[model samples]
Target: MSKRVASSTDDVASSKKAKIQDDDDDDSAYLEEHKIVVEGGDARPIRDFGAFNEKARHQLEAAFAAPTPTQAISWALALRGSDVISIAKTGSGKTLGFLLPAFHKMEQKTVRGACSPQVLVLAPTRELATQIGVEAAKFAPAFAVRTATVFGGAPKWEQNHQLKILGGRGCVVGTPGRVNDFLDSNKIQFSLLETLVLDEADRMLDMGFEPQIRSIVAKISRPTQTLLYSATWDNKVQKVAATLLRNPVKFVLGDAGTKLVANKDIAQTVEVLDESKKTARAVEFVAAREAAKLIVFVATKRGCDALCRDLRRTTKCDALHGDKDQHERNRVIDKFRKSKKGVLVATDVAARGLDINDVTHVLCYDFPKGTHGVEDYIHRIGRTGRAGNKGRSHVFVTPQDSNLPALVRILQDADQPVPDDLKQLAFTRRSGGRGRGYSRGRGGSSSYGFRGRGSSSYYGSRPTGRFSSSSSSSSSGTKIRF
Candidate 1:
């Protein structure tokens, strides 16, 4: 699929007006294209908050003329002081969903006393926490609302200074460790917090921050609004919700809160190659396509470095992983976001919440590991194909990796096209395995049981690829078409 550039200025103006007018009758018309419908009950668009503090409403309107689906649901449910678990796709305005409620609660308290921040937001990465801080500022500017971000790799003294300035008067957004540190030191009082938000809860759990999360939550008083938001809600989230929330209102934004579906605007393709040859194939593919703004996801941090070195010898590329210093990682992300043609080789650390929306292509250098890994997969590919724009994702699969079948099944079930070669590879892996509970491919069967063979279920489907290499040169960089 060809990429769709934004229309001319006049065209954009006309469309915006049409959407605003449609807002009264049925805002769904403007959002229907992006809506993900589920069974059992139809999900309605989020309702407006009439009783909210005017300052909070103004901020929400400025950030988005109309609230996004996640934002709407969160505002309605969370502002009512309900515990919520929000499951939504990345870049679908999930941040604002929680932020709006936090802002309203803060504003309400401000009316009684000089705003003592009663909200705590925990994010998986410093970058994400910083992003949330920025959003929170935009959402509650009226209440002298300040957001103090606490993360590692920065000087502790500087963070302490920020906390001292906060003085229990503004929101505290930070990683679990730093937040816990502040709580232990009595620099921040968790008991005063009226809301606790666990952003990217699944990622935090995977990072072994569960102990810290529980510790921090234990510090906060009861009757606090607990909001958990993630791209996917697997067993871990359910377990946490059961323990933390009291009759929570669960909001699954897209496709019943399973693995985030591949963005419909993206055209995905898979290339089957030997494990040893995957890197070579990737370099060849990138060199052949002259892809601008590329991101490659590898499984390990060491793999990220090696791939960057290899790609850098032939083409300019940068590497990002957990190993890099936070400042350096932030610099690389900024540079990549601005560069016209550059590639960033990364691990899952860069996958969850780093928003580099201009990425033109996502190349999966390694297959993701499990269900949570699949959430990372969607986030990686979702770097491209944003805001109704078209993008491409190419997955490099090997015969030895038996997980390809389940991956293909997930994509197909999500309405994405699975290449013919991928289907052939799945059949080969299933039959070739030595009595490993593999079944013959059933023709025209939507539901095939391929469970426990790999990590996830093979949902409904059998699905139905070629390559060419060519190169062209442009001023920004060389162009390769494949």
Candidate 2:
């Protein structure tokens, strides 16, 4: 809302460049395990939650099974910088990483300033903000501290009452847009804010909320403690971490369950299909699973609606997207989650914060594109195969995807084999505004990784020939006409 940026202490800004270097940096992608070290700081281990404030201990155990590696590292190195940047796997208990610290810091404050809160937690999506608020609610009662959540798609009156009327205090978890709305109207201020956290920060950047986040942080009265978290260290994330954190500590933990690099438990495969026949292919896959919970990702809200409608005839299916009201979105998600087995078609919005475990399949009905490249592909597939469980992902690719080259490089770097056909698509350039049709594979209908169990190959040896999808999963080869 405010164009002004958060003021930084000159002393802190000057010392930012001379950060302690990580010399013994034995950072490995896989295999050899290493502990976390922050900016030359010694590798730290997770401490016991037993020593936390009496109320804090109760909430910590209630909210999580136990402190995750990221949460532990975050709390372990909490004081290294006024800001800390933690990147860890999704669903690995990232919420408490900042929440615990913020509440703990609040416990020490003796004075309450007018219109200024002690802490601010910013999230990219309402669902995420609401989720944080729920966790905060569960924990704050033990400490007698108040928490408020502000987001769109809800009555602003109640949120306003919580902040303006009752006096926002203890903690506030909210989406950037709604937070900006309040900040712009001068109803809220961060003068007393001691700690600020950006959760799921990469998603905020992808959603283009950088300007709002900057404006919100810049207005903090003093050098506020900041914590930034995300699943990947893409360039945008790195840049923000550099600008916002002062001599910060960085902890990069591979995915939670396996403790190896991310996405190890999930087997991924892709099908290059014609646009007209893509829906048929997707249905075939879902029908094959029968009762498994399936999440089909589409590119547009309209696509989500259309595909969900088509799939409804075969089985009960639902859709989720920004276009749907928050009430409807919640209902759809709850219904799908409770059904034990159902289909949900959605845009990339569901890629993050819509935590529905037990999802057996993540189908990319429409492939990722533009800024939402391989990074997003990872998040979408991440929904399934979580908490040590195994899952499968199927991506549908078409010639229209300019993202093919990047996907090829990503797969190659990860040691996953490049689909033989995808390699050609990645290397070729558009010729005279015309692209080549998908090469026909010889024998089997394209089903990913059906050969055996516990396979990690992403492309599954590429279909030998072009084949159509069939109503039956065991069909030898289903053929389709162009």
Candidate 3:
């Protein structure tokens, strides 16, 4: 009789504990429903995420107290096998926009096995891939999720080990090439893949990862929610989106009718100067703020090396280009990041993956080539003024028959005042943009065209083809972030 009484007492205690736990869950759900709303802009802090569980909510709120433009919308709710295409400027907290949703969905489901990655994020460069991996690591612990990064420079075996052993059907952030290779090796399973994110989709296409990206996407048979993010859109970007997305919602951040354009926060200007005076102007610009971090962009490898050599004689600056191996590139970038008045002379290689903080100015020492349109120009200038910080972007265009009219048209389209010097170089407005104007609808098309290569000079006849009048210094462009 005494034993039976004790058993009944234990059963009653268990039932009471279960009831209390249910009450706590119900309370959490109620609070979450009211807490997810965020008012616009940087005016106020984000209320806690009602959708995230207690641990995830605490961790995310700790990492980021304020909601970015990307976070203003609930992207996590869109993870129901739907397609999402998000276009925002660089440093817009896009990484988290997709990551949080992906993490939430992964946490909801069970992995069949270790073969397939629950989430796959493709970035154009290793640095970007690693950056995303770092972000994943920050949240993985709170959610008890495993994350792995795969890229070319890193050890293949180590990545394999991480995914197969360390990662238990977790997330994989990697470059297209490396991930494609893994797909070939049968090392990763996509049988239960949940979400796929293509960050910087346009740059991946620009870097010629189209074949690899397409192949990987084709292999996934699982019903996966796709999220495509790009800074700019073109034929290639649209093509990828159409092929991958299924009736996705398109959002352009700004006034209702405004199309995507350069961030308005950047003060933009173009100087019409002779090549002989290029170095002197650069030196003067850097001297303006002896401690101002700057980035100077050049067009060629030789130009990158020559400019770095010249700048070092008077100012402390380093060269960055594709020629440098990953180690040296990391060293230079790291050193520059820590320097107060550091300057980096680089080619287009630095345009995409290099995201440093507090970049004050971006100087184009050399005019970009013809194939490089206003979109490329935007990316170069985008190096600075990131994350809503005020920045200055200046492009130097020499008076030549080939590029003068193009620059004139570009400046006018950007709603910037054309300098008297550039106005003198341009001919009477003729050709394409008479009635359509710069706002050519959604494509971000400029009526004033600047096809740098092989164009009939409407202006006074001047020598065409590519021409750069570099001074003895041979530097093209440089940028600094402090």
Task: Tell me each candidate's TM-score.
Answer: 0.74, 0.75, 0.73
RMSD for all candidates, in order, please. 12.2, 12.0, 10.9
The models' CA-based lDDT, in order, is 0.68, 0.68, 0.68
Stretch of 10 with least lDDT, candidate 1: 457-466
How do these models rank on TM-score, best leading? 2, 1, 3
Residues 1-482 of candidate 1 have per-residue lDDT tens digits of: 22343456667899899987676447455245545432222234565645466776666556445666777666767767778888777766677678766766776554322223477899988878876776676555665666777887777787777666654447878999988887787777755677889998988988899999999878766578888887777898789988998878786765736654666667777765434445556677667656578888887776677677767657888888888987898788878877888888888777765665567888987777665556566777887875345788887665445566677766786677665556765776666653223222455222222323232211101100011111111211112232
Between prediction 1 and prediction 2, the one with superior TM-score is 2
Against the true structure, whose TM-score is highest?
Answer: 2
Better of 1 and 3 by lDDT: 3
lDDT of 2 by residue, 277-393 (tens): 565666677777787888988877766776677677677788888998988987887787678887888888778866766788888776776665677787888888865477778
Looking at model 2, residue 453 earns an lDDT score of 33
lDDT of 1 at 409: 69
Q: What lDDT is reached at residue 206 by model 2?
A: 81
